[model samples]
Target: MRAALAALLLAMPAAAQTGDLVATDALRVCADPANLPFSNDRGEGFENRIATLLARALDRKLDYVFFPQVQGFVRNTLRAGRCDLVMGTVAGDELMQNTNPYYHTTYVIAYRRDRPVPERLDDPAMKSLRLGAIARTPPIDLLLRNGLIGNARFFPLAVDTRHESPGADLMQAVADGELDAALVWGPIAGYQAKVKGLPIALRALPTEAGVARMDFFITMGIRAQEPEWRRRINTAIRDHQGEIDAILRDYGVPLLDAEGRLQPP
Candidate 1:
């Protein structure tokens, strides 16, 4: 029934293994204050909406420690005793225990709907087109092997996202005809396309096409010692998947089921 979003430490974790990070009175979440379509301080992102749902479901006050999702996000927020939950994490991240995957997504080729769709990175038509991708993402390697990098623009990866929107900038280039197409994470392209009503079509890439892994299953993260907390989150995810899916779809998230079928809203 209550909430707090603070940039400073509002709660501290105990050094001992006593489940101190898990909040008993509030559903405390660790989130990036400015990472849009995922999280933001304004509570407009899908993760913020979902966290609200989780807090409501658990009958706890909603709370957050707002930090940028940078190098020490886990150590400074969830691990340092400031927050209890992270709404989205790669499924197998070693720094924290993960709940059951809540959704699956992949890298995508984003092009104007009026243009010829490129189904894969190796699409022959792509060779002649101006392309864009993030510097360190999986598509860069594929672009290199396909001899497409020479024609591609690679944006800096993992920039200080708190004040930057590299993904949106890259997608906008495609929409503006600066680039014929761009390869970006599905969620980023999808969210921007939906929000701006951009006429972009996104083509999902394979998880493992012998170049680099692209698809990812995203899960909630909690501390390693919180088995019961992890199980609770799993149950929460299972029970509220419909609500979760709706929120993601509302935010233009491209999703796939566990069986790999596209979930189009």
Candidate 2:
């Protein structure tokens, strides 16, 4: 019976093969309904705005397939034929073909304004401060390498998307004095720090030897079989680079150049 079931499942067409990119009137975007600075149901995240722009450029109405961006996000949404695009993803994801990079950002430090900020992982002051960062993140590895892990508080890398933003929680802890400082993703740290009215200073961490590169280029993700669709998305990204930069700036994303210097709007 198990072999028969397995054979039946094998006969089912793969999602991508079942649905080709068709000329549609609505641009279907897959997004996290609660993740801010990236996406949300209210269309307030930078990726939301970018999706809108992309839809408009393509002369299609904007629509979204809202889901929590957690484990199996790509498989359950994009690969399940529920949406046509993911507005923001790592540039070189192995699960899907990626468009040309739209923006680059890095990990950042979030600390209370009144407290001394440790600009680098190797700062001597960090040895004494109670640092916080998401567990399994690049920053945590850096902390461990520099012997700062002993004093660090680690949060879960994947939180329940239903009720938590780990980055925001870490920043709030900093503001409330429970933590001396926190290392968080640049976009989330900057947006949360400003929007939550926390008296915090956000600074992008510079790349250093022995630390994994903190910077990453972001791009749109499309099904690997949809080359024409990927090309269209890339064209839209290239045509609206200036507008996309503006949206990212509004969200306080720490845009950086290849040389690691901050980019101005």
lDDT of each: 0.86, 0.83
Candidate 2 per-residue C-alpha lDDT over 1-265 given as tens digits, one digit per residue, 9 for 90 to 100: 9999987787654534434654367899999998887888998788899999999999999989998888899999888888889877888899888989999999988888898675667778778889899998888777878898899998887876669878778888998999998888888887876655678887777667877888899988888767667777889999999999888888788899878787763
| RMSD of every prediction | 7.7, 7.8
Error of 2 at 89 (Å): 0.6
**Candidate that scores best on lDDT:** 1
Where does model 2 exceed 4 Å of error? 1-23
lDDT of 2: 0.83
CA shift at 58, candidate 2, in angstroms? 0.6
